[model samples]
Target: MTARRPTAIDIVEVGPRDGLQNDSRHLSTEAKVEMIAKLAGAGLRRIEAASFVNPKRVPQMADAEAVLARVVDLPGVSVSGLVLNGRGFERALAAGLREISFVAVATDTMAARNQGTTARGLVETWAGIAKRAEAEGLFRSVTIAVAFGCPFEGEVPLARVIEIARALAESGADEISLADTIGVATPLAVEERFAALSEAVPGLPMRAHFHNTRNTGYANADAALRSGVTVLDASLGGLGGCPFAPGATGNIATEDLVSMLERDRVATGVSLELLRDATLWLEGEMGRRLPAHGAHVSPWPRVLAA
Candidate 1:
């Protein structure tokens, strides 16, 4: 018997924030705003517009407030920001962002390198942020990076991943995301982990964030879908990588994912042609070819007269 398929899926576009954060090129606030608007126009409902982190650390996100200020008016678009601590959360709140993503690494070493704290310490910090968000009626999603394997510490234990996920759930995270920070996860691993997480968390929605580093990103996405994950994170033009993880690559490309999903009859509410066009525009702005496959290929082929 064939497994039941979901009628639709939620795709959270992370281009403006996660996509550009590690880039050497700095996009002006205007460029960022324009990119976000184009994404919204292409029917992406949830977009991660900015990251309220220290500019000294991730200079690409230095214009978070300015970008948010300009893109907050897009109709039907839910703009969100990434906040690692109470300070970042406060700044997002001040910027009128109603949704926020909080991240915690799976291993202590990764946590220390990314957030200047241990995994447990970052959980504690997120607890306070979650509490405040709950009180303020804001949406909170906690992403556990390196859920499959850590760059510093290879093959993070499943028990450890579950433990950290439980802590974040207890802290009142509305959604939980499992991140393949260095793109080391296989389909079997994604299936097992997400199935275990579903059993462990029971009711909370799950999201998958995969990188195409070793070319397994789309496979992992398929696994997540089969495991009942409702939300997925992708970047426009496949434009993201972890600065702390050596050799890590970009997230699965939004247009590429959309093309695959739509072909499979999964509704993403995103227009593939428009998304591809956006990637082309982004390529022009960056003056380089992006890593997204859909950006380089057409969804439909033209027919020649026989």
Candidate 2:
């Protein structure tokens, strides 16, 4: 058998938004700005800086607009924000953000819990949002969440995800993403589902957002890459969880994913040293420890002793 060649990996840092939103500790705008700047200095080109959502639900993202303004001008870094509704999308556009991502779940139960609407209504709403963003020339992409599996409603059918992807693509979304929102996916499930998605939507740029709750995040990420997924969403120091999905851990750690990619010779355009520093600074700002394997486990001494 022939060896499979390594593929280019695009690590999209979602720590600023996803990681911080679920955190109990509220971070100041300066802290958020510093964290993003450090990540940028670490060679991360794509970072989801913040989300424009109701402050009542996610107080951590209350200063999203300010954060975006502070970090968008940095060189070689593209900042993106997550918008849940038309109002949120408008806020992102008004903030001069060129990249935005919207999400809808695959099951009605999960959708209602997450978005306060049925899955069908959520899809319709996102389609309209995609059209509006396309007309305004501000929307960059849209993502359908819980595409792989749902917590409220376990075992989301592959057909549902494919249907949502097709609808999003048809609605003029430039890119689509599948999220393991509850972290219930195994490697086999990841491969099968992603393969089905590839066959269903050929050439449509897709991203995978996996959580490390079940310890299958890295394995699932490797599966996604092999299945032709290029964009991978991760959080620095594993900083996020689904507020709606109880017991859900953080997203795949940015440092851990980057380490895997670099060791495998995959091009991620990220610096481990800079990422480690970002994680440490984030932990300091949060006044607690975050879950990052590479940061928690050091290799400096081993390499030096050798």
User: Per-residue lDDT tens digits of candidate 1, residues 26-72?
Assistant: 78788898899999999999999988889898888888888898887
- Compute the lDDT of residue 160 as modeled in candidate 1: 97
Query: Which candidate wins on TM-score?
Result: 1
After aligning candidate 2 to the native by TM-score, how far in Å is the CA of 240 from where it should be? 1.5
Global lDDT of each model?
Answer: 0.89, 0.84
Evaluated at residue 147, the lDDT of candidate 2 is: 76
lDDT, residue 266, candidate 2: 88
Candidate 1 to truth, TM: 0.96
Against the true structure, candidate 2 has what lDDT? 0.84
Instruction: For candidate 1, list the clashing residue pairs, or say none.
Output: none
lDDT per residue as tens, model 2, 1-306: 423525676788999988988888888999899989888898888899998889887889889988888988888888889988889988988888778888877889977876789888878888788887888886467677887777677788889888877777777776778899878888788788878887878988778899988889999898888777889999999998887667767999989898888878788988898888888888888888887778878754356643
Candidate 2 matches the true fold with a TM-score of 0.94
Of candidate 1, the 10-residue stretch with the lowest lDDT total is 296-305
